[model samples]
Target: MTGSPVTTENVDPLAGVRAPGDPACDVYLTGTVFLDIIFTGLDSAPVRGTESWARGMGSSPGGVANMATALARLGLRTSLAAAFGDDKYGEYCWETLERGEGIDLSLSRTVPGWHSPVTVSMAYEGERTMVSHGHEAPVSEALPGPPPARSCVASLRAGAPQEWIAAAARAGSRVFADTGWDDTGAWDLAALPDLAHCEAFLPNAAEAMRYTRTDNPRAAARALTEIVPLAVVTMGAEGAYAADGRTGETAEVPAILVEALDTTGAGDVFVAGFVTGTLAGWPLGDRLALAGLTAALSVQEFGGSLSAPGWDEVAAWWRRVRDLTPADGRLAASLDRYGFLSGLLPEPAHPWPRRRAVPTLGFRALP
Candidate 1:
């Protein structure tokens, strides 16, 4: 990734070439970062005449910014390319993106407004209902060019300039676009022909199925390949499925073992983990395992990015989970080898590393 605090003479993106011997290690993460200023106003689990509730405030991030934050925290070289207003909210998002050790914002653009792109997540019985207002619009700012030579995962602004996605594809960077789950309207998936340039197309079951115009999710996954090279359909508890090309084989990967909380950015978190693992040369099963575990860990917390586990922690957690499940022995050995190379493991444990959080039914964490 381009924004890691660590830089190498061989790894410069401007070189239009990846440093030698780091093929599995090259990546650049770019997208939006925003403020998720939360206000706790709703009851924990509204019941009959449950009018009494508490009030508090928490500030985290929302949208792609939060997802990028999670990726950076996991120690990838990340470049955030979204535009923000030159005001407080934009400033807030900018500072948050730069707050983490491995994130860089040189590619971030600023518009002429005080409002930033943000969402208000209202907690309701451990889940969130968002009331969002974007004071900063995407049209008012300029986005930097897509990275050259390095690999990338675009947040897939369905309505944004298709040129950006195309440029990324032309550059040798693989695309993994994320949608905000809003109706596409005029910005339908059909408009983004650049999706064919992406190595993997990830869409939630509802979104993918809708885009493909089919209720049978497996068929939808297959149909998506007619447009893109490959597709991964994320189904919440049923886990996720993958297929490639027009007639590629599909496989089912089971969900990781974990108690659920709020599955806010579970999809985005899955992309980050899977893409990171793929760049590291992990096999299909391991990539799916990483995605599944990351998504599972994501729901056990309050907000989007903050809920994601760091890479080492996730790898450690994967190891612990691998022991309890009857997974392929090769995956266990491969994870172990990668761990040793990355200095990630000091022996291993059977249970995944667990993170616990208190749940509130109706309140947003302030950003």
Candidate 2:
């Protein structure tokens, strides 16, 4: 029997929408651009000085590529600003994201004689370890201009300069910021000023704890509220914590669990979903739930940027259980809660093409 028609009762009417003349793009992201070589299917970490083998290997643009592609897959008109080397690797990355994923890279440049950054990631037991090379220098401060949109995504790490944030704010753009994993544990307090300029500060639970000098994720999120007007701390598997400085409200959402194959870009996908919900003016709880589901779906496949689900996948999910009985329990309950799914549009005609040799993992080396 076929599933029943989906219902829209209790769904937020404004779950996803772009305001008229809001921005040139839905989300503008700026950060490092790297060619990612990902290897998977390892049962354990490599032994000291020993050779190890991997079952799967795929190459794709890493770093901000993950966020840019995810945003586009979610039907957001996305843009990226970064420096790329005038090398074959860079060309591959540019074409994959720009042509294959429909991302605007007009603000990104290709530097002559510079080799693009490359990262080799090894995935094992739901965790990943990456070794990278060729990051010679940061994208020059002059390279990235003011965000050309009303909403932008930024990284708080050293690589992402703060000048763009300042310029974007002056232009009345909303900035959403996230940070990188700190290997040194210094947890630089200086980054706080840059974060202050963001409309929302989203950091993982560990990063938030260290940055706020608190052990509890909720407490850390609360402390961040004192800085940015909105704060969200993502806790892998457990869920997410959020604090709204404007309404003096707080919320926690449970993670959506699924069989995870590779969690490479789950966080970035989560950010895309959260941004989608936020732009739609969904309630904080709805935003978190949507983000959690997006991340959950990403881990079900291989590759990083390529694994991101599009509107088609989301629509299929809704259709699968549209007619299921409430007695169907958790899945049914979640689908009902996300009744806003009814508003989702199908994948556009001539929506970016996918490379066949590797299927959905859009990786094409420059010939």
Candidate 3:
């Protein structure tokens, strides 16, 4: 209702890249949506069995919905593509978003006999673990594909349908997709190859190693080049690396020096920040550092969007680091790579549909 666009596709993430260009939507998420029910003190030292502990009640939209909502708050013309039921939660979701300024909801499809998906989050001390459940519904909402938006960043997890993918590519937009696999015990990594046509393919280093079956991050990143010229692999703490033809490079983004309270959706924050910098014409390493900083701030709070940092906040933090010149190797390196760089190529080769499998989230050592 805030004017943010919305789309819903039945994405079987394991389907290996659903087809390029999904009507040029900004982002597509295919995953189990959850409510993110959390207990503030759950992670704290627990008393014997179930002792009476103090906590707060919170019910908010989560997953890709949560990510898009957060980005909208940062003043972006973001569109969300997902599914929900024609139930009470669905109404609340719509109402809550409507009240929030800076988002559009025209793309939200209300499916009959379906319940809005949710995740119960138990946030006690510093960690949040999610027990997620998805509502089963028919894919009957025949909404038309969206035309190319400003910049498309699609995260294929578990909710979108296959047809939408083809529609997205047809829109002719700057596309980037993160990996999301719906391995409900059925191992299929179809999204990997399908995202090949995107401008950037960002998968965690661990997932790339396992899914691509490669040991080196550079090789894995470059390998993704065949699918899309610029492929990136993010290494938590170590930094993020990218490869594209004779332009292969890696930069270490320094992690924020904050005691992380919760890491749920930290990855999503990183993606949003990175993409924001990219669309703003910032250098890659700077973009990565900005992403890491945003993610670091996210873990210091609870919930998904509730913990996100606005642009001003991020800029302030970056200025502090720059002025202080703290000796953090990773962040310093990222700045060096991205700082004062100009007149770079405007675009990398478009990604061909992926030909390999999308790996599950995990970790991989760098070469």
Top candidate, metric lDDT: 2
Instruction: Please provide, for model 2 over 1-367, each residue's C-alpha lDDT reduced to its tens digit, 9 standing for 90 to 100.
Output: 9965433211222334645666667778887788888788888988899999988777888888999988887767788988887888898889889988889998888887788998888889988898889856543534757556758888777434577787887778788988888766678656456776789988999899998899899999999888899999999879998999899988888887787877888989988888888888888888888888778878877677867877656655666556578897677777656776666544233222222114223435589
Shift in Å, residue 94, candidate 1: 2.6
Each prediction's RMSD over C-alphas, in Å, is 7.0, 5.6, 12.4
Query: Weakest 10 consecutive residues, lDDT, candidate 3?
Result: 352-361
The residue-level lDDT of candidate 2 at 266 comes to 90
Which pairs clash (backbone N, Cα, C closer than 3 Å) in model 2?
4-323
Candidate 3 local lDDT, 175-291, one digit each (tens): 667875547633234534456446777888877665566897767777767667567788776667767553665555545566765676778888887776666665567777667
* lDDT comparing candidate 1 with the true structure: 0.63
TM-score result, candidate 2: 0.85
Full candidate order by lDDT, most accurate first: 2, 1, 3
TM per candidate = 0.75, 0.85, 0.72
Worst 10 residues of 2 by lDDT: 348-357
Q: How big is the positional error of residue 152 in model 1, measured in Å on the Cα after superposition?
A: 2.6
lDDT of each: 0.63, 0.77, 0.58
